[model samples]
Target: MRFFEATHKYPFDWETVSLASFRKYPNDKTPHVQHVEVLNQEIDPETGVLKTERLIMVKQNAPRLMMKLLGGSDSSYVLEYSEVDPRDKTLTMHSTNLTFSNLLTVGEKIVYKPDPEDTKNSTLFAQSAKLSADGVLSRFSSYIEETCLKRFHDNALVGKLGLEQVLHKILAEKRQERGGAGNMAA
Candidate 1:
Protein backbone atom coordinates (compact mmCIF):
# COMPACT_ATOMS: atom_id res chain seq x y z
CA MET A 1 0.00 0.00 0.00
CA ARG A 2 1.29 3.50 -0.92
CA PHE A 3 0.83 6.08 1.80
CA PHE A 4 0.50 9.76 0.87
CA GLU A 5 0.73 12.60 3.35
CA ALA A 6 0.54 16.34 2.80
CA THR A 7 3.19 18.37 4.56
CA HIS A 8 3.70 22.07 5.30
CA LYS A 9 6.78 22.18 3.09
CA TYR A 10 5.09 23.98 0.23
CA PRO A 11 7.66 26.31 -1.33
CA PHE A 12 7.29 30.11 -1.47
CA ASP A 13 9.40 33.27 -1.41
CA TRP A 14 7.75 36.67 -1.84
CA GLU A 15 10.58 38.73 -3.34
CA THR A 16 11.50 36.03 -5.81
CA VAL A 17 7.89 35.48 -6.78
CA SER A 18 7.28 39.21 -7.26
CA LEU A 19 10.32 39.73 -9.46
CA ALA A 20 9.65 36.63 -11.51
CA SER A 21 6.03 37.57 -12.11
CA PHE A 22 6.97 41.07 -13.27
CA ARG A 23 9.74 39.81 -15.52
CA LYS A 24 7.34 37.47 -17.21
CA TYR A 25 4.71 40.15 -17.81
CA PRO A 26 5.75 43.79 -17.90
CA ASN A 27 3.17 46.49 -18.49
CA ASP A 28 2.29 50.18 -18.63
CA LYS A 29 -1.46 49.95 -18.37
CA THR A 30 -4.04 52.22 -16.69
CA PRO A 31 -4.61 49.77 -13.85
CA HIS A 32 -1.41 48.35 -12.40
CA VAL A 33 -1.63 45.05 -10.57
CA GLN A 34 0.94 43.73 -8.20
CA HIS A 35 1.53 39.98 -8.04
CA VAL A 36 -0.20 37.66 -5.62
CA GLU A 37 1.82 38.75 -2.62
CA VAL A 38 2.56 36.66 0.41
CA LEU A 39 2.19 38.89 3.43
CA ASN A 40 3.58 36.32 5.80
CA GLN A 41 4.08 32.55 6.11
CA GLU A 42 4.71 30.23 9.02
CA ILE A 43 5.04 26.51 9.53
CA ASP A 44 3.93 24.47 12.50
CA PRO A 45 6.53 21.92 13.51
CA GLU A 46 4.16 19.84 15.58
CA THR A 47 1.45 19.64 12.92
CA GLY A 48 3.51 19.92 9.73
CA VAL A 49 1.11 22.49 8.30
CA LEU A 50 1.83 25.65 6.33
CA LYS A 51 -0.10 28.84 6.82
CA THR A 52 -0.10 31.93 4.58
CA GLU A 53 -2.19 34.94 3.63
CA ARG A 54 -1.97 36.44 0.14
CA LEU A 55 -2.43 40.13 -0.69
CA ILE A 56 -2.98 41.76 -4.04
CA MET A 57 -3.77 45.44 -4.78
CA VAL A 58 -5.02 46.98 -8.01
CA LYS A 59 -5.09 50.73 -8.64
CA GLN A 60 -6.41 52.96 -11.38
CA ASN A 61 -4.53 56.13 -12.22
CA ALA A 62 -6.19 59.40 -11.37
CA PRO A 63 -6.53 61.93 -14.14
CA ARG A 64 -4.43 65.04 -13.75
CA LEU A 65 -5.62 68.48 -14.88
CA MET A 66 -3.51 68.33 -18.02
CA MET A 67 -4.55 64.74 -18.66
CA LYS A 68 -8.18 65.66 -18.17
CA LEU A 69 -7.77 68.35 -20.81
CA LEU A 70 -5.68 66.08 -23.06
CA GLY A 71 -7.92 63.05 -22.36
CA GLY A 72 -7.41 61.49 -18.95
CA SER A 73 -5.51 58.24 -18.10
CA ASP A 74 -3.28 58.62 -21.15
CA SER A 75 -0.94 60.73 -19.04
CA SER A 76 -1.72 59.19 -15.69
CA TYR A 77 -0.39 56.23 -13.77
CA VAL A 78 -2.19 53.89 -11.43
CA LEU A 79 -0.46 51.90 -8.71
CA GLU A 80 -1.99 48.92 -6.99
CA TYR A 81 -1.09 48.43 -3.37
CA SER A 82 -1.83 45.14 -1.60
CA GLU A 83 -1.15 43.79 1.87
CA VAL A 84 -2.17 40.66 3.70
CA ASP A 85 -3.45 40.76 7.24
CA PRO A 86 -1.97 37.66 8.83
CA ARG A 87 -3.76 38.01 12.14
CA ASP A 88 -7.17 38.49 10.61
CA LYS A 89 -6.57 36.28 7.56
CA THR A 90 -7.65 38.99 5.19
CA LEU A 91 -6.31 40.48 1.96
CA THR A 92 -6.48 44.18 1.15
CA MET A 93 -5.79 46.00 -2.11
CA HIS A 94 -6.28 49.55 -3.33
CA SER A 95 -5.47 51.68 -6.32
CA THR A 96 -3.96 55.16 -6.21
CA ASN A 97 -3.87 57.58 -9.10
CA LEU A 98 -0.76 59.51 -10.07
CA THR A 99 0.09 61.98 -12.79
CA PHE A 100 3.05 61.31 -15.01
CA SER A 101 4.09 64.94 -14.85
CA ASN A 102 4.07 65.33 -11.05
CA LEU A 103 6.47 62.51 -10.32
CA LEU A 104 9.62 63.50 -8.40
CA THR A 105 12.99 61.86 -8.73
CA VAL A 106 14.79 60.14 -5.90
CA GLY A 107 16.44 62.59 -3.45
CA GLU A 108 14.44 65.50 -4.89
CA LYS A 109 12.01 67.36 -2.63
CA ILE A 110 8.88 69.29 -3.58
CA VAL A 111 7.60 71.67 -0.93
CA TYR A 112 3.97 72.76 -0.89
CA LYS A 113 3.46 76.46 -0.24
CA PRO A 114 -0.09 77.46 0.59
CA ASP A 115 -1.30 80.82 -0.72
CA PRO A 116 -2.88 82.73 2.17
CA GLU A 117 -4.90 84.82 -0.26
CA ASP A 118 -6.57 81.86 -2.01
CA THR A 119 -7.91 79.51 0.57
CA LYS A 120 -9.02 76.96 -2.02
CA ASN A 121 -5.64 76.89 -3.71
CA SER A 122 -3.98 76.68 -0.33
CA THR A 123 -6.04 73.68 0.64
CA LEU A 124 -5.30 71.85 -2.60
CA PHE A 125 -1.60 72.65 -2.48
CA ALA A 126 -1.36 71.70 1.17
CA GLN A 127 -2.87 68.29 0.52
CA SER A 128 -0.70 67.57 -2.50
CA ALA A 129 2.47 65.60 -1.97
CA LYS A 130 5.77 66.05 -3.75
CA LEU A 131 4.37 63.39 -6.07
CA SER A 132 7.46 61.37 -6.81
CA ALA A 133 7.73 57.66 -7.44
CA ASP A 134 10.81 57.45 -5.27
CA GLY A 135 9.10 59.17 -2.36
CA VAL A 136 6.10 56.88 -2.57
CA LEU A 137 8.30 53.81 -2.85
CA SER A 138 10.35 54.90 0.16
CA ARG A 139 7.28 55.48 2.28
CA PHE A 140 5.68 52.26 1.09
CA SER A 141 8.74 50.18 1.90
CA SER A 142 9.03 51.74 5.34
CA TYR A 143 5.41 50.95 6.09
CA ILE A 144 5.86 47.33 5.07
CA GLU A 145 8.94 47.04 7.23
CA GLU A 146 7.37 48.57 10.31
CA THR A 147 3.76 47.50 10.30
CA CYS A 148 3.29 44.49 8.01
CA LEU A 149 6.10 42.34 9.37
CA LYS A 150 4.70 41.88 12.87
CA ARG A 151 1.19 41.36 11.61
CA PHE A 152 2.48 38.75 9.19
CA HIS A 153 3.99 36.71 12.00
CA ASP A 154 0.74 36.78 13.89
CA ASN A 155 -1.22 35.79 10.80
CA ALA A 156 1.15 32.95 10.07
CA LEU A 157 0.54 31.56 13.55
CA VAL A 158 -3.19 31.83 13.11
CA GLY A 159 -3.05 30.22 9.70
CA LYS A 160 -0.91 27.44 10.97
CA LEU A 161 -3.56 26.71 13.54
CA GLY A 162 -6.79 27.63 11.84
CA LEU A 163 -6.14 26.93 8.17
CA GLU A 164 -3.12 24.75 7.42
CA GLN A 165 -3.10 22.49 10.46
CA VAL A 166 -6.81 22.07 10.26
CA LEU A 167 -6.58 20.96 6.64
CA HIS A 168 -4.13 18.20 7.50
CA LYS A 169 -6.15 17.08 10.45
CA ILE A 170 -9.23 16.79 8.27
CA LEU A 171 -7.34 14.89 5.62
CA ALA A 172 -5.93 12.50 8.16
CA GLU A 173 -9.36 11.97 9.58
CA LYS A 174 -10.77 11.20 6.15
CA ARG A 175 -8.00 8.70 5.47
CA GLN A 176 -8.67 7.01 8.78
CA GLU A 177 -12.36 6.92 8.05
CA ARG A 178 -11.67 5.13 4.77
CA GLY A 179 -9.32 2.56 6.29
CA GLY A 180 -12.08 0.07 7.22
CA ALA A 181 -14.67 -0.22 9.94
CA GLY A 182 -14.14 -3.66 11.50
CA ASN A 183 -13.52 -6.73 9.32
CA MET A 184 -9.88 -7.75 9.92
CA ALA A 185 -8.71 -10.16 7.28
CA ALA A 186 -5.37 -11.76 8.14
Candidate 2:
Protein backbone atom coordinates (compact mmCIF):
# COMPACT_ATOMS: atom_id res chain seq x y z
CA MET A 1 0.00 0.00 0.00
CA ARG A 2 1.20 3.51 -0.81
CA PHE A 3 -0.19 6.93 0.11
CA PHE A 4 -0.03 10.28 -1.68
CA GLU A 5 -1.04 13.74 -0.58
CA ALA A 6 -1.09 17.20 -2.13
CA THR A 7 -2.39 20.70 -1.51
CA HIS A 8 -3.35 23.50 -3.87
CA LYS A 9 -4.68 27.03 -3.65
CA TYR A 10 -7.32 28.41 -6.01
CA PRO A 11 -7.96 32.08 -6.65
CA PHE A 12 -11.70 31.75 -6.20
CA ASP A 13 -14.13 31.84 -3.33
CA TRP A 14 -15.12 28.54 -1.76
CA GLU A 15 -18.71 28.75 -2.99
CA THR A 16 -17.69 29.32 -6.59
CA VAL A 17 -15.03 26.65 -6.42
CA SER A 18 -17.50 24.16 -4.95
CA LEU A 19 -19.96 24.73 -7.75
CA ALA A 20 -17.22 24.51 -10.35
CA SER A 21 -16.03 21.21 -8.92
CA PHE A 22 -19.45 19.66 -9.52
CA ARG A 23 -19.38 20.83 -13.12
CA LYS A 24 -15.78 19.81 -13.78
CA TYR A 25 -16.63 16.84 -15.99
CA PRO A 26 -16.83 16.98 -19.80
CA ASN A 27 -14.00 19.47 -19.88
CA ASP A 28 -11.31 19.33 -22.56
CA LYS A 29 -8.39 18.73 -20.23
CA THR A 30 -9.73 15.45 -18.90
CA PRO A 31 -10.58 13.38 -21.94
CA HIS A 32 -9.92 10.22 -19.99
CA VAL A 33 -13.12 10.78 -18.07
CA GLN A 34 -15.63 9.52 -20.63
CA HIS A 35 -18.95 9.56 -18.77
CA VAL A 36 -20.54 10.55 -15.48
CA GLU A 37 -23.85 9.43 -14.03
CA VAL A 38 -25.34 10.97 -10.96
CA LEU A 39 -26.70 8.07 -8.94
CA ASN A 40 -28.16 10.13 -6.15
CA GLN A 41 -28.32 13.69 -4.80
CA GLU A 42 -30.17 15.26 -1.89
CA ILE A 43 -29.93 17.72 0.92
CA ASP A 44 -30.04 16.76 4.57
CA PRO A 45 -32.78 18.97 5.89
CA GLU A 46 -31.56 18.82 9.44
CA THR A 47 -27.90 19.44 8.76
CA GLY A 48 -28.45 21.46 5.61
CA VAL A 49 -25.71 19.53 3.87
CA LEU A 50 -25.84 18.44 0.25
CA LYS A 51 -24.87 14.83 -0.48
CA THR A 52 -24.31 13.19 -3.83
CA GLU A 53 -23.09 9.97 -5.44
CA ARG A 54 -21.88 9.55 -8.98
CA LEU A 55 -20.50 6.79 -11.18
CA ILE A 56 -17.71 7.76 -13.55
CA MET A 57 -16.39 5.80 -16.51
CA VAL A 58 -12.72 6.37 -17.23
CA LYS A 59 -10.56 5.23 -20.12
CA GLN A 60 -7.39 4.71 -18.13
CA ASN A 61 -4.09 4.48 -19.98
CA ALA A 62 -2.78 1.51 -18.17
CA PRO A 63 0.81 0.37 -18.57
CA ARG A 64 1.46 -2.67 -20.72
CA LEU A 65 2.10 -4.92 -17.74
CA MET A 66 -0.97 -3.64 -15.91
CA MET A 67 -3.06 -4.11 -19.04
CA LYS A 68 -2.08 -7.75 -19.18
CA LEU A 69 -3.11 -8.13 -15.56
CA LEU A 70 -6.47 -6.56 -16.29
CA GLY A 71 -7.10 -8.87 -19.24
CA GLY A 72 -6.51 -6.14 -21.79
CA SER A 73 -9.28 -3.91 -20.46
CA ASP A 74 -8.51 -0.20 -20.42
CA SER A 75 -11.76 1.10 -18.98
CA SER A 76 -12.92 1.16 -15.37
CA TYR A 77 -15.78 2.42 -13.28
CA VAL A 78 -15.31 4.64 -10.22
CA LEU A 79 -17.81 5.38 -7.49
CA GLU A 80 -17.67 8.93 -6.13
CA TYR A 81 -19.36 10.36 -3.06
CA SER A 82 -19.37 13.96 -1.98
CA GLU A 83 -20.77 16.20 0.71
CA VAL A 84 -21.09 19.96 0.71
CA ASP A 85 -21.64 21.95 3.89
CA PRO A 86 -22.53 25.49 3.05
CA ARG A 87 -22.63 26.50 6.69
CA ASP A 88 -19.04 25.35 7.11
CA LYS A 89 -17.96 26.52 3.68
CA THR A 90 -16.42 23.16 2.96
CA LEU A 91 -16.76 20.35 0.44
CA THR A 92 -15.46 16.83 0.89
CA MET A 93 -15.33 13.97 -1.59
CA HIS A 94 -14.23 10.36 -1.83
CA SER A 95 -13.81 8.07 -4.83
CA THR A 96 -12.78 4.45 -5.40
CA ASN A 97 -12.57 2.24 -8.44
CA LEU A 98 -15.08 -0.61 -8.63
CA THR A 99 -13.57 -2.56 -11.51
CA PHE A 100 -10.33 -4.56 -11.28
CA SER A 101 -10.09 -3.62 -7.63
CA ASN A 102 -8.33 -6.83 -6.75
CA LEU A 103 -5.51 -6.10 -9.11
CA LEU A 104 -5.31 -2.39 -8.28
CA THR A 105 -7.45 -0.46 -5.83
CA VAL A 106 -7.13 3.31 -5.72
CA GLY A 107 -9.11 5.35 -3.23
CA GLU A 108 -8.94 9.14 -3.07
CA LYS A 109 -10.31 11.81 -0.76
CA ILE A 110 -10.35 15.56 -1.21
CA VAL A 111 -11.35 18.54 0.89
CA TYR A 112 -12.08 22.06 -0.28
CA LYS A 113 -12.33 24.79 2.26
CA PRO A 114 -12.22 28.55 2.47
CA ASP A 115 -8.78 30.01 2.88
CA PRO A 116 -8.71 31.69 6.25
CA GLU A 117 -6.41 34.51 5.26
CA ASP A 118 -8.15 35.21 1.97
CA THR A 119 -11.62 33.89 2.49
CA LYS A 120 -13.23 36.22 0.01
CA ASN A 121 -11.05 35.34 -2.99
CA SER A 122 -9.15 32.15 -2.29
CA THR A 123 -9.82 28.51 -1.43
CA LEU A 124 -7.69 25.74 -0.02
CA PHE A 125 -7.72 22.29 -1.60
CA ALA A 126 -6.17 19.20 -0.05
CA GLN A 127 -6.14 15.67 -1.41
CA SER A 128 -4.93 12.25 -0.36
CA ALA A 129 -5.00 8.83 -1.98
CA LYS A 130 -4.08 5.26 -1.27
CA LEU A 131 -3.05 2.71 -3.88
CA SER A 132 -2.90 -1.01 -3.24
CA ALA A 133 -2.41 -4.03 -5.44
CA ASP A 134 -2.94 -7.68 -4.60
CA GLY A 135 -4.22 -11.02 -5.94
CA VAL A 136 -2.38 -12.35 -9.00
CA LEU A 137 -0.59 -9.04 -9.39
CA SER A 138 0.88 -9.20 -5.90
CA ARG A 139 4.29 -10.03 -7.27
CA PHE A 140 4.36 -6.80 -9.23
CA SER A 141 2.70 -4.75 -6.55
CA SER A 142 5.63 -2.42 -5.99
CA TYR A 143 6.04 -1.59 -9.65
CA ILE A 144 2.32 -1.20 -10.21
CA GLU A 145 1.90 1.01 -7.18
CA GLU A 146 4.79 3.23 -8.26
CA THR A 147 3.46 3.66 -11.76
CA CYS A 148 -0.09 4.29 -10.60
CA LEU A 149 0.99 6.84 -8.03
CA LYS A 150 3.09 8.70 -10.58
CA ARG A 151 0.18 8.81 -12.98
CA PHE A 152 -2.12 10.08 -10.26
CA HIS A 153 0.32 12.82 -9.26
CA ASP A 154 0.51 14.03 -12.84
CA ASN A 155 -3.25 13.84 -13.25
CA ALA A 156 -3.72 16.02 -10.18
CA LEU A 157 -2.28 19.00 -12.02
CA VAL A 158 -4.55 18.36 -14.98
CA GLY A 159 -7.56 18.11 -12.70
CA LYS A 160 -6.74 21.52 -11.20
CA LEU A 161 -6.45 23.05 -14.65
CA GLY A 162 -9.82 21.56 -15.63
CA LEU A 163 -11.44 23.06 -12.56
CA GLU A 164 -9.93 26.45 -13.34
CA GLN A 165 -11.35 26.30 -16.87
CA VAL A 166 -14.83 25.47 -15.58
CA LEU A 167 -14.69 28.26 -13.03
CA HIS A 168 -13.59 30.81 -15.61
CA LYS A 169 -16.41 29.83 -17.94
CA ILE A 170 -19.00 30.14 -15.19
CA LEU A 171 -17.71 33.54 -14.09
CA ALA A 172 -17.69 34.79 -17.67
CA GLU A 173 -21.30 33.74 -18.14
CA LYS A 174 -22.32 35.55 -14.98
CA ARG A 175 -20.52 38.67 -16.13
CA GLN A 176 -22.26 38.55 -19.50
CA GLU A 177 -25.63 38.16 -17.83
CA ARG A 178 -25.05 41.21 -15.68
CA GLY A 179 -23.77 43.23 -18.60
CA GLY A 180 -26.77 42.31 -20.76
CA ALA A 181 -29.16 43.26 -17.99
CA GLY A 182 -27.47 46.66 -17.52
CA ASN A 183 -27.55 47.32 -21.25
CA MET A 184 -31.28 46.60 -21.37
CA ALA A 185 -31.84 49.05 -18.48
CA ALA A 186 -29.90 51.72 -20.42
Provide TM-scores for the models. Answer: 0.24, 0.95
Which of the numbered candidates is closest to the native, going by highest TM-score?
Answer: 2
lDDT score of residue 55 within candidate 1: 47
- Clash count for candidate 2 is 0
Cα lDDT, model 1, residue 39 = 59
Best model per lDDT: 2
- Candidate 1 TM-score versus the reference: 0.24
Note the residue pairs that clash in candidate 1.
59-95, 62-97, 86-155, 104-132
Residue lDDT tens for model 2, 1-186: 889999999999999999999999999998889999999999999999999999999998888866764576788899999999989999999999998887789999999999999999999999999998864456678888888899999888899899999999989988999999999999
Q: How much lDDT does candidate 1 score?
A: 0.33
Candidate 1: deviation at residue 34, Å? Answer: 20
| lDDT agreement of model 2 with the native | 0.92
Candidate 1 residue spans exceeding 4 A from truth = 1-141, 179-186
lDDT of each: 0.33, 0.92
Q: What does candidate 1's lDDT look like per residue over 1-186, in tens digits?
A: 011112232122222222222232223321244344555566656654444443443343333543454464433243434343333322333333433333322111111222335423221111111122333356444542333234334433443344333334444655676664432432
Q: In candidate 1, how many Å is residue 88 off? A: 34
